[model samples]
Target: MHVLLISQYFLPETGGTTNRVASLAKGLQSKGHDVVVITAKPSHPEGVIWEGYQDDGLVRDEQEGIPTVHTWVYADFEKTLFTRLCSYLSFMCSSVLGAVRERGSFDVILAFSPPLFVGLAGWITARLLNAEFVFDVRDLWPDLAVAMNELNGPVKIGLARWLEHFLYHRADAITAATDGFCESITSITGPDTPVQRVMNGTEPEVFRRDEAGKKLRKEGGFDDRFVVTYAGNIGICQGLDHILEAADRLAEDRSGVLFRFVGSGPVKDDLQREAKRRGLDNVEFHPRVSLDEAAAHMAAADALLVPLADHEIYRSFIPSKLFDSMAAGRPVLLSVDGEARSILEDAEAGRYYPAEDGQELASNIRWMLDHPEACTEMGENGRNYARTHCTREAQAERMTAFLEELIG
Candidate 1:
């Protein structure tokens, strides 16, 4: 089978979507399927090209035998609405042109959604090539953007809603990252749209317990503190200000608790400044690290934090960081609601707090700190759950089976 994957972000971007797509492409190649990824140059949260790389319009590369074609897009990392819209549009146009120029016989087209425009391009390309289109919904667009207050105009929201319907209905099949998202897509596309729930997962091999965590803790002088870490994008949707507030509450526990933030995003700088102004010595900010480094940091943490804003749309979303935390055998302090809470509760993998409830978050962290035995048990449960259901191998096998069914 030959599969063409379309996404705006890919390797070196260091996010769940990038890692998931890379893992899937490699997994398909390993199973004797030809896979090619169409993506933009590495310009994500930082919105800048990697230090050694130049913005050539199109470049061919390979990762673990899977071929990839990267196209140039926006280089700005600003969080403003206009800049983000330009970023999405730029990728949509460039990717379409790149895909056309590098046309090859493909059996199926797999495109990811968030910046929903990319899926539109992929759908058009699939139509041109007469290929099966598999639309992977990582985030419900327009609705999510609107809920986040990123798209506010009445006319613009209506147009985005229509575009959402247009893409989902046109796709031959759809795969969603959560059951809630699957339900929403089904509602939009009809009862028989062939939507599957391929929940986000982690590469167990890369996220397992490691000595690097201890080394990092020692070097950072946190060997004696109960390190609570948040290891992903520090964006608005994350609602990480709650974590800062929680840190402020625990500021007096100088030697007992420490907060570590190990990623970069639009809100990171502001969060740092807020922490500094609040005179919270317990909170520490670290720049985004490599995938391996992130795994190490997770392992070093006494617990991992997964925070989300209180929003109706977010109830259907699951943060990929949750899977990484589980794979690392670390207990999680989840500040989310609805489906995410249900998942963690069912798995018995961690404790949860109401979204945006800083008091609840603080209380949960304090409890985890005080009950070391319970914390260890929760961590063990998370690791077992990840191995049983949320590992890369498990997800890849499921995805491959789905592809086979589609082709059949």
Candidate 2:
């Protein structure tokens, strides 16, 4: 089968979305399916194009053995609404034009969403090529936006719902990253809508704990202090300020608990300011690294920090960081609730704190520091669970089955 996979973000962009899309395309290609990935030219969370990579026009490249089509987008993670809209719109218009111009036929068109407008292009492309459409709901878009208070006003919300339904109804098959997402789509599109759960997972072969991880910590300036690490986009939905506040509560502790944040986003500067204001000297911040690098840091840390904004939408969000943490064989300090909590509790992976409660998080951190035996056991359990159940190779095979079913 031939596939045209479309997403706004792809490899080298640090996030679960990047891993999910790129890994699947490569996996399909390995299985003899011709896959062409259409994406923006590497500009992501920061919004600017990747260094040394200019987006002058449509660029062609190969990513993990799969052919790639790069479209120009007004990419920038500007705070203003207009600027962000332009970023999304440029990608949508350019991708549609590129899809139409590309010569050839495809068996299926897989569309990933967050900037839901891109689904329109996917639907259009599928119709244009008379191909099947598969919508991958990685994030429940406008609904998630509404819960995060990013989207408001009845008019806009109504239109977003309409768009979402239109695309879902048109899709020959829909795959969501979690059961919560599957339920959400089924509720809207009815029980008959073909919805499956193809969770976000990492390549186990690439992410594992080894002696080199310990060497990495020493080389990266980390020492014997008990380290609690949070590595990902420091965006608003992350509620990273709570982590800084938690650090404040432990400021006087002589146990040598060090908090480290990795990755860049809209709120990195503010979190730094808040940490400084509180005079917390134990906290350190680092820029984002590639996926393998992130795994190395996670493996080296004594414990991993998994947090999310305290909101209804986040209840359904299983932070992809949890899966990565498990792969690193580190006990997690989970600060979110609902689906994420269930996963950690069932895996016996780590302890959880009340959402948005820095004092609770602080207490949990201290507990994690003192109970080395428990942490070690929890980390082992997490690693076993991740290896046994969730793996990139397995997810790709499941997705392939869905494609074949839909195409037939």
Q: Which predicted model would earn the best TM-score?
A: 1
Off by over 4 Å in 2: 51-55
Residues 1-408, candidate 1: write the lDDT tens digits: 989999998875777888898888877877899888989888776778775457565878885566878887878877788988888898888887877887568899899998898899889888878889999999989888988889999899999999999998999999989998998888889987799988879887688856888898899888998999999888888888888788888777634888899988888889989998999888888988889888999999999998888888888888888888888888889876787788788888899888888788888888887789999999889888888888877787789889989999
User: What would the per-residue lDDT of candidate 2 be over residues 260-280, giving only the tens digit for each residue?
Assistant: 898988889988988888888
lDDT of 1 at 213: 86
lDDT of 1 at 228: 93
Cα error, candidate 2, residue 74 (Å): 0.6
For model 1, the run of ten residues with the poorest summed lDDT = 49-58
What C-alpha lDDT values do all the predictions have? Answer: 0.85, 0.84
